[model samples]
Target: MKNSTLLLAIASAMLLQAAPAVAQNNVPIRKIKAVRPTTELTLLDRVESDTHRKIYQYNEYGYITSVMEYNKEAEQWVLDTDNSYRQEYVFNAAGQCTARTSFNVDKAGNKTTEKNKAEVEVIGDKTWERYYKEYPDSTTHISEAFAYDKWGNCVEEILYGYDSYSKMETIRTYNKREYSGPVDKYTDNSNYESFKNGRLLYYLKARGFDDQITMNTNELFVEEFRKIVWQTENDKLYRREYGLDRGMDIQVGSIEKNMWKSSESEFTLNADGTRPVKETVRSYDETGEVKYDYTSHTYTWDDRGRLLASFEYNESPSEVSYKGEYTYADDYAKTLSLREAIAELSCGNQIYPEDEFLQFGRIATSSYYYAEDGDKGESTYEWNADGQLTGGKWSETCITSEPDTDNPTTRTDYGETRVGYNADGHMAWKIDHSITENEFIKIEYLYDKEGIWTGEAEYDGDSWDGPWTKEGERGNARARKRLATRAATTPKFIDDMTDGSHNIENNDGVWNTNGNYNVTDGVVTGGGYQQTLASNASVPANPQYNYTDPLMPLEGEEDEEVFTNEAEAVWSYTWNPQKGDWESEWSPTEAKRVYNKDGNIVADIYDGNQTIVSTITYRLDDDGRLIEEIYSKGGNITYEYLPGTDYLLESVETAADNSRNVCHYYYSKHNYVDPTGIESIKRNDVSTPVWYDLQGRRITTPTSKGIYIVNGKKVMVR
Candidate 1:
């Protein structure tokens, strides 16, 4: 058929349909991209075995336009056909880049398509929209919609397709859910797995199962998702999936996860099902060649599913090559206890590596003393009641651990930390890390009355007090300790400020907030959160500045240990050379401030180069405690103040352009005014910070360590 004939046929079908309605899966999910706006970029015009050069092109809007694969052809730009793509986009009413679609185009411009459509809508101030798309179908296609929160983070994605041919217009659905409170520290592990149909696909075994498993993805593909039916001891879970790519076997897998919470925290799981415990894997083409593989192992548990051992397998023929097994007490089948587990594991020795006794003995842990023979001859370990691997030594010297179990009353001094179990089998304690050499750490965790770890905290009593670290980490003991520290110093800052408990005294001088930022004064400072402080120290260049004092603890104060608290910083300003009416308003003008006994501001002199630009005074009025702000421009006093509400009810401003701007503001639970009466514009967005250890290995907090030019590949610093 001619191209014109095909276009006519498509037009005819469209005309027959009449409305904007898509026919019953008439468009394959693949064609969705082509119908969108298409653009292209050419990367390597050609690559040469000896003189090949690389090129990269991007769309004007900063997106990838094209990447070309080429080979050397007389050392010139010659067409190479291997891998390339063309992208398409669509704009919504606002023209802010609503959608980005993609297609794989051959050198001839023939496009191989993927028929996925992302539906978007702005829920609030968030930029990224959620997503939804239907499964691909040449005849009957459906659509899915994605939903996002204010920060452009995906909240939920639902896969929806419709069977229009059915008399009842059947709707097929799958829903992926997300936690609403904060960013996912580990999405796959902490976020339960779900299918579009709302089925919980898989739950995590521990907080960081992905890190602990250390297996490759290819191996897991065959073991877990590849299995049809799976069983784990007496418990069982069922799952199912289908895809034509599975070849003749109709690749589908289902496994039963006998999920349960275990350990002091980090709910470690032990089971035997269709899923392999740990392994790396990769796939291959029809030719008998190595594709890629993940090293993986399947963990096994005792009769009651207590973690016993892990079985590792290789790729290709899929053969078991290594194993790490554990021994549990006979009573463990009924209940898992630390003492019983320790004794049972004590007898453990490596079953395989008969010649590599050293490798075998290492897995037993130090609680049950054993020796592993290696080049250095022997290695051993020791553990306190707390289960911390406190000792690791070679034949020459040893790092031994001594548990301060002297406190028989609580039997809680499991070394430096105090440990007691909640009804839910979770551990709680005050981890003391106050000692210098010992680094005595006290991790205290709080359980809801039901014994669920509700408040986890870590404390460094010397430098700071209260809670310094608190979060929900379910697996690693170290993580739990850190959480305890955070929980200890975790103040009710946000909660207290909401009620105006730490109301700014409305005094003089720049009211610097302590490291513990709980509330802001009444002044209209920019930078911090709350609706009013949009202009005060809101400049990111001075990110360390807050309207009120910060909550950083003095070093060594926790135990008289004078630590360098210099890492903590106060707000600083940079000089901008430009100045105008509006420009001066944007500038951090010089200001005088008077503080109350509690370090709260009582009165402030808003001075722009000692010109007495404004005066913000806090006082009691007939209605209630009120803040009065008087702006002095052109020798005229423009006053505005409200008794209760943090709003400017009077006139203001004397810019060079005479642009007398006046505005009012309000506050809510999620909003507030600073001590200077400035309403914060942006909220406290805690991104990953630049991390530094004693070794000075600096890693940016966001975990996006910029690419390190090492031998051409970017690897982690630690």
Candidate 2:
């Protein structure tokens, strides 16, 4: 997510001011402590996984002396020489970090040092920092400096180039007093301040781009934000006075005509400080007859502080309000306990005895868009006790009154979808049905013994009887996306039980029954199971589903699936520079896979540098079931699943690659037959007596309406 716009400096200034400033304390400064991971889970597609652990050697003063990688085969920690990485920290006599060096190391254990230094100065509450990086290439050298105020607030920054000319400078100013709470719910566009001392007031930046010089300034006012006023001014030197001809006066006039632009916004707030309920923004044009009127935006939120609806409108005659409403599977009313439920219904007025209300006991059951030529729609959802989404429906009536009598009086269409999950809680199958025609499509997902989705297939109807077959130029790509339309529209929203806040807010015992899908904290370490391909096929094992047409099809060739193996084969990926992530789609800097003697892909190295960025060594059991995966980065995860089921028995993780932290796996006796039975024991521990405020302070009692901590954990006590 790189910002290409030159005005990025203004956006960055806004971001810096949004965060509150931290107050400068007179106490001894706390040195940054080195962070070490106790557990890491290797991601499937990315080159770097959280499971890859980097161990650090710390000096007596708690500063990191060296960092090393885990060596799998040797079962030892080694210096990071593969990428030629080395770092060391230097401190002044006052114990303050003064300088740091990061260079490279060759395979022969020799250092390739470069001149990189960072100078720091501190006097009372003020500080200064200067950085210099001189690489072998002179053009690569970088010099930057920063100044802080008495409250440790950044006041200025400067950047210098190899030449005598200064590249850029940024200056910042602050408000006289820190803002106190009861903040306006509307018109408050200010950032969440980080400093307890003062709010940010202005940001001024000057930079040289190519041969042109430009200046930008942003000022902020902290006047309760009942009304917001925003302005932007830009000044530029078209050309140096030494080079400009007599026509320079005319160029200067043109620049002045478009020198600056300004805007203003006003807003109204809800009872809570979540966000503005309504806002209006207006822009000004100085040089043209075209005048811009105010554009307004409105929003609505649920009791839980989640946005439920929103809309926008403009003052133009042709413009109409566009609105949308979001509905969740579980609302605040449905998540209440039996006791609280009765109290809510009674509204604190005892209409009848509480016992009578609970006599037989128990149980139960649980958007709009607009224009004058109007389209109306409604959406509803279904879920199980565990808050796992099971089904949903959306219907819309485009034209309420048909223009022609021969056509249907009303044009109404509906889309209904149902989903099924595997034993491990991962999506297994989904059916999308067109209610009007009774036509439906089904997609089945295939996975290995570890429950990682490997392949997918789509059928024509609710049952696998109807298969979708295609013969075309992009047959392979189309086959991969047979169910693409359905997957693209699948709702990412989860039910209340899956919201993570449910357990903390509702103390009444209401257990989740959706199976062990997203829950990972209590996953006991241990075990290995044989990977097997089940003979069961969602679709018939007929001639249609297979792809035995050609080993490598010619360009623009047309071939159909004749008989492809049901088991998922190899995997491929591409890097998406725009997203800064590796994607399954093709990319320029993609990795190439090579097969080993065992016919397994052992390495995936980058094409440009041939660097072994990712390596996966598999250890198969007698039955050829993948029992272990050895990563080049030294971290390995072993899996064991229940027979014939995707449910895992145990997954043992190493603190680092081949670290001694590996522990023995054990199985405890249980009454329930499956892994879901362990949910009782996996519940979060809440035995200790502890309390905390909304600010995360350990307090004796609650003093505000926000979140609170009790029994050593967060729990909403309001």
Candidate 3:
């Protein structure tokens, strides 16, 4: 078998289909030992290596109370007292963990402790939990409270966190949910009557009973489609103005309570409740009076629920922003629409119709227009008989208005791409042609015998008659032989190029840095930087590998930690082949960076003379979620998310000329994750294992023997 089969076997073996060992049910695992053989020759000419062990202790209630780790030293197991070495837990009478403490030992034999404690309180219908963590240099306190209704449904939750180092107490999250009681039927003529009358329904702007509708009799459909958020300023300067203390018992003034920014959204749904028909959003700044920034989108859909047209609008100067229109085609000579096919399927008792069987929702053409400079573009698609996208053509026209000329200049660009698929429905090759640039490129995908994608080759021209450039060749014949030899001999620095463990860009059999100078493979050479496996043998004077690119880094120096929570100074040098060593000169294009406490880059300064080049600042909520990013150069970007969630809702980018571009993200509730359906089964030692194809489709009978998934493990069938 090949390495691809072995890799698949290892991944599939984790999904065990057998039942648990009943004999080991009452056996508590006390300790686990792991050993790895090393190649270091011992005094007696025997190999020696270190071993590791982990010891676990459990309380009477079957909860882990303590865990200790040890490493073998000179044939003796010694306690490992490094950072985060040991952990001890304290439990209450109800068998709930109340506190946890981790032990750390420094190089000077000094031990420090980090502790976390949680306290819970139960009031009338609410529960509160306060968690506190104490570190060596800082402390964090979080308070969470939840309120439940009569049916035990949590209706409200509030979370707050206080940071000692930042000396700020902030509201991390606040969310409230409302559910309607069981209703016989919906009688609201303003909203429900329109939906039943085959008219497009719009969500009402009201306080209660407007956001949701009743889907069926005696059932309430409460979906959260819109939300509003308020943000407050909590920088160091703002906290200092309030005279706040480091402790959590400080009082906050009215100035700190005032909202600095706020946003509101409205959503309108279609008739089938499948997708949104329109969305409107507005942002406000509340420094003095409210200043509004608004954007809106309206969509037109066909009878099959496919989008036909869309329009975007901005409210600052009240103008149209963008417009797009779409056209679709079907397999039936474009005569039968998808809506008619769906009607037939629904009447024929088809509850769920698969696309492979229906085959009616293929897009044909799409056109877009921008209102800023009157630019327009269009793309047309072609599909094969199997409904696979075969090729596409894109053309765009750019209009530029000149200050001195009355007539605007227009230029058009065109491009096309074609795809080829294998018998297994996997993309085999792709060719891209740019008529504007007069360039052509082709890429071919390589797969193993089992139809698993292994590598790919790229060609510069249209023909495939010359030597090709390859990448991701981990499972190929040549790479497999090299990997076997590497397994027996350990090198000083692991060469990621041939190890198949890392992704490196290889262009025409040459390893290019792709403009990133920070990468180093721990080897220095006169050519530049040769990332090769280290050995005792001397390197040839003129090696086969050539890396004489001037932009490549010969040496790198840093004044501070690069990616830590502070500023850093960096310098890079090019190779000086004449001097037979690295040059003392630095690249003027190199830059140093300064970071804030949140590890966000605050400034970028030129490294050659230490002059400020550009600055970037970020605003974040208490939960460390970025809200806005400001760039000193030209533009700023702001982000919005769904309330009490990390899912991004929208992002707006404003250019220096005050032109705004907005994007919205929508999620559907119908798409959900299915359970794995893994269950324990009785062990059968005499039964044969089942087999499946590489695509996870069950293989009923084997015509020819090859690599197949058997009993949830990949194996060769003889």
The TM-score values for the models, in the order shown, are: 0.24, 0.35, 0.34
lDDT of candidate 2 at residue 634, scale 0 to 100: 76
| Residue-wise C-alpha lDDT for candidate 3, range 452-499, written one tens digit per residue | 444444555533232332232121344344545675453212234321
- C-alpha RMSD by candidate, in order: 29.9, 23.8, 24.8
Better of 2 and 3 by lDDT: 3
lDDT, candidate 2, at 675: 20
Weakest ten-residue segment in model 1 by summed lDDT: 7-16
- Per-residue lDDT of 611-715 in model 1, one digit per residue for the tens? 444544333345432233233333222433322332323334346456554322221111112112222111123233544533456644423322222222222
lDDT tens per residue, model 2, 1-718: 0111100001111111111111111111222222332322111110112223333333343333343343343654344564333556666665566656555556444557644555666766556676666543522354666666654445556665554246332322211211222111211222222212113333333333444332322222112111111222222101101111222222222333333334445445456433356555545454322345464667675665444565767585346566655545445333433223222322321112121112122111115556754666665556678645565666666655543455545577777667678887766666666677676666565554434344445445433344542111112333234434445533111122232222111101111011111212432121111111111112211111111112111111013243333332222333233543333432235343433336332434443332447766655445444456677777875654323322233345564535633322122222223221111111133344476665677765554434455655444331
Model 3 spans > 4 angstroms off: 1-296, 314-319, 331-361, 384-388, 400-409, 419-431, 440-718
* After superposition, candidate 2 runs with Cα above 4 Å error: 1-87, 91-98, 102-114, 119-130, 135-159, 164-206, 209-261, 268-278, 287-290, 294-320, 323-366, 382-391, 400-410, 417-718
Residue 687: error of model 1 in Å?
52
Top candidate on TM-score is 2
In candidate 3, list every pair of residues with a backbone clash.
Answer: none
Which prediction has the highest lDDT against the true structure?
3
